[model samples]
Target chain A: MGQVLAPGVTAPDFTLHVTPDQTLSLSDLRGRPAILAFYPADWSPVCGDQMAVYNQVLPEFREHDAEVVGISVDSAWCHQAFAETRHLHFPLLADFEPKGAIARQYGAYRDGEGVCERALFVVDRDGIIFWSYRSPIAVNPGADGILDALDRLEKQENSDGRAQSAGNGG
Target chain B: MAELKVPVTAADHARGGANGQVVLVEYGDYECPYCRLAHVQVMQLGRHFGDDLTYVFRHFPLTEIHPFAEPAAEAAEFAGAQGRFWDMHDAIYAHQEQLSLLFLMGAARALGLSERTLEVALEAHTYAPKVAQDFRGGIRSGVNGTPTFFINGHRHDGPFDYQHLADAIQSVRSGL
Candidate 1:
């Protein structure tokens, strides 16, 4: 229910902790399409269900050459516990140092609530935001939209490649 | 808002007429308690609608929470291989609380399935890919939770209680 970071903009880049010792930057994931799942908090009911659904569909995401990363205001320690408890295979980056700094960059931070809104962003291989959605905090917004965007991205890339080949021949 | 991305095909485990007036597709997890409750409602719906409704069940196992979910789904798929998918499906929900490897084998036995065959299938994970396929289809169809239903290719966004689902079916039927 908030203004999402619109498509076609260069997605704001950030580095965040995935584990106590490991950190990942958005720029590092630019060569492949990536899905950023911004959620309110770790260990909440809807958040748990949302992440679990993504975990189950990781293979499908991979087929489209996409990698998923969950971002939240929770600390790295909290994320580690929740990720382990849920058996999440994807990295859950903590936006905790400045507390919602990365989320604020994407307009996903709920200022007064002290949490991030439930949102999703699909960043293309070139780091441009391809699609984004802000869902109600209580709803587990399913993976359909992300997959649709990825499908479109794949088709567009195919056409672009064909056009480039035609240009070369000309 | 969500539509069924993949149409039901011969590979799906379905009941009732192939050309039935209404099709009800459920994305269910065998280990989910809500899915167990919905199972009874689904059965009632089948009885109430009879030949007018085609019921299809697909796997959406929350394996992280319910460790046995994937295995239970695999058991059902193995039963499907022997042409007893519904029987295994029914047995699993009926004995929902007793979902263990041994219990699944017992259910297979009760359905007159070869216990040896099921054992081999489970150990070999012969049906895991089929369960994974169902899960992927459910994700593509916008299934966010257990017991998600789609009637006539549209996601049922309301509660899945008997009354609500019955009315939903009626509405779709009347539209047709």
Candidate 2:
């Protein structure tokens, strides 16, 4: 398993292909909280089940303006097939070419495995990592942890907003 | 293991086997295939452990993917209003392959629930708050997906298949 980042780190930036022709960058998610789901592979049992769970809960995430993106070392073409099979609405970014490059920056790439650890990172609107978790390789770490992080993020923002208003005597 | 944050109360739908030695709480979605399978297994467990088990179900509908789930849950609540909660629940899971508003209405009618009243409740989402409460409780209890189980107020991370669950229930039952 790779390293799991702690909260408050500046989430590393990268652009990865979502489809053969379309790519998404970390900057694309600047205005909203982004959930970076780094998993080992597309079709592996646990990964597939985990992604499907996220697919089912995507709306709940969007209710908080959090966009979920899956990352893996698979090629974009492979991602295309896998996303199709799963009917996933979110984009799965392929950390290809320099395989596991982005995952490595997040300390989520498994050494010599050529795959990602079952890692999760929640990045705030300012690109600061809000929370992260690395789960066991075989277990399908469900969306609960990600959702909890998002909820915490929302709570923090709300309280900060209240504090700012209080400072302004509003 | 995560423990159940909310204890079972009269607000919940519960059924018991003989001695009530174990409590199995399932956070389930009506549209989830795994939950449908677990429904059957839970029923089987009901037969096997008769008086020793008390099974409880709560809604955790993944509405984004399973749009019909929330509506189906509402219908179940509608039936619950008439004291036919378990009947409606079993009916919906029995026809799990065909879950929809129309199917739910049909099931409601078959169970002697007024179709128009069910429609009104569905449109108004009368039970959504209750379902959402169950959902929040599940989230707080570390439920990640449909068919998540809590055995005697503790999270059961192991497989919920018949034998595994039987062993789990047996262990919990024996502990009492």
Candidate 3:
């Protein structure tokens, strides 16, 4: 839970009701890599900018075969409004009632602020966590930062898979 | 030979004392909206209680996120030094978004301070240490983020409305 979602640990899956999109569960996204961008609140200036950045760079995410999703403690209604206002192409999942229950499960909840800090998680095709970064509540861990890390994980995994195949052939 | 261990004094902190009453200690950044929201409640509580409660504002700037927060906090402290702390505090909250030196100086002018003097104070980096001290104090007291408050030393662990905060303060008063 402390900074290492490690390479092999299976991600804990939950079905969160998202908006302007549909409900999503980690299990439903199996057989494909995905990125979860956990932000503090929707409609917040910084958060709006973060999602907009993701929308602009969505093509880059598609090239990596990854679906990017944003989660927050805001209600579905708020997410809908925020998505419409910001023109975000990605789904913004509502984690409102429990107030950071999932964020705490992911070790992104900050005790002091009573809100989920900004965090990013990359899950592999096998549903194992590949990369993660959680910024302190106030600062944003920009989408580009996550993309860079995701790129690294993808390259590393591909090279390892190729090496394993060569060994098997040998 | 004995190692000298100095005890921290209450005078060292404007908020700490054994009043046995619930004191709402708010560790906030000037630029934080949540802090601004909670500040309004703090002011309201003053009207509701009428001298029965104390609210202490501690500075904890998330400098990495809000680049101007620390500077704003320092300016507030400089204003506080001239007995205009609360006025400047309110002004900052009132003008949270446009947190520029020029805006702060305008606040100083509105508060009847010499603009030149306040500008020099801001440029001197005068109150940064005090604001930084508040952040260190918050960390030592288990504050990991902004808008953290302690109701009679028990942390307010969730989003709170005015009623909830009033109730907590009442509980502390009864216990005292």
Candidate 4:
């Protein structure tokens, strides 16, 4: 297992292909919080179900205004087929051309397996990582931690918004 | 690795492993195809372990994907009230392709359990809370999908094939 990027660090930015033609950078979703789900493969038993669970809970993530994006080392074509098979609504970024480069930047790449570790990052509205978790390769680290981290991020945002408003009033 | 947040108790439906040296808990869904395969694997493993392995099954339905899962879990729980949990659990998985509200009702009847009791409970959503509690507990234990296993309290972070699971069990038991 690789040493994962921890909370309080700025999330490393990369623009990966969402499909053959389109690319999405981390900063593209700068203002709203995002849940970066870095998994091992496409259509594998664990990763498929993990992403499906996230797809199922998209509404809950939306309640906190967080966008969920899947990152893996599979090719864009492979991801497209997987997304179609799984009926995935979210974008699956291909860390393919460079082969786990983005995953390596996030410290989620497994040098031994040539795939990303099952990892998660909850980046706050300002692009600072509010929380991060790395699960064992075999376990599907569910959406609970992501939701909890987003909850805390929302509460902090609420309090910070109030403080800013109060300061402006004065 | 995540630990089994809820300890095995009388409330859980356990089989075959009395005074067992190892405890294997599975968070499962009736509608999951993989779980059907896991069901058979567990049976074999139980026979192998006998008194050394106690197998406990918990409900962690992926309700969004498998809409029948929660209700099936509730039916299993209702049957559990009559000491027929394992019966209903097996009957439901016996025909994984035939899972639905209609299938559950028929399975209950085929097993010679009460339809009225199950209907009333399903209507009232009586066992839904218990199912939800199990689901929440699974999330707490880092269970993202069905057929997750915890061997002797620690999550089994390996493939869920028969041989791999058997090896994992052997290793865990020897460590004990």
* Model 1: CA > 4 A from native: A162-170, B16-20, B47-51
lDDT of 1 by residue, B70-146 (tens): 88999999999889999899999999999999999899889889888989998999999998888878888899888
Q: How would you order the candidates by DockQ, starting with the best?
A: 1, 4, 2, 3
User: For model 1, how does the per-residue alpha-carbon lDDT over A1-170 read when each residue is reduced to its tens digit?
Assistant: 35889999999999999999999999999888999999999998668878989988888899888999999999999999999998999999999989999899898999889999889999998999999999877667889999999998877877667323344221
Model 4 over residues B138-167: C-alpha lDDT tens digits? Answer: 766767777889998888877888999999
C-alpha positional error of residue B61 in candidate 2 after TM-score superposition, expressed in Å: 2.4
Best-fitting candidate, scored by DockQ: 1
Model-by-model DockQ, in order: 0.62, 0.32, 0.03, 0.43
Candidate 3 CAPRI category: incorrect
Name the runs in model 4 displaced over 4 angstroms: A1-4, A14-25, A28-32, A56-66, A73-81, A94-101, A109-115, A135-139, A144-170
What C-alpha lDDT values do all the predictions have?
0.90, 0.86, 0.71, 0.87
Q: Mind giving the per-residue lDDT tens digits that candidate 4 earns over A1-170? A: 65899899999999999999999999999988999999999988778889987876787788788899999999999999998877788999999988999999999999988999999999987889899999878778888788778878877777667322344221
True contacts kept of 2: 0.23
| Clash pairs (backbone) in predicted model 4 | none
> What ordering of candidates by lDDT runs from best to worst?
1, 4, 2, 3
Candidate 3 Cα misplacement greater than 4 A, ranges: A1-170, B1-20
- Top of the candidates by lDDT: 1
* DockQ (model 2, Cα): 0.32
TM-score winner between 2 and 3, please give it. 2
Alpha carbon deviation, residue B149, candidate 1 (Å): 1.2
Q: Ten consecutive residues with minimal summed lDDT in candidate 2 chain A?
A: A161-170
| Interface RMSD of the candidates, in order | 1.3, 3.1, 11.5, 2.3
Error of 3 at A83 (Å): 19
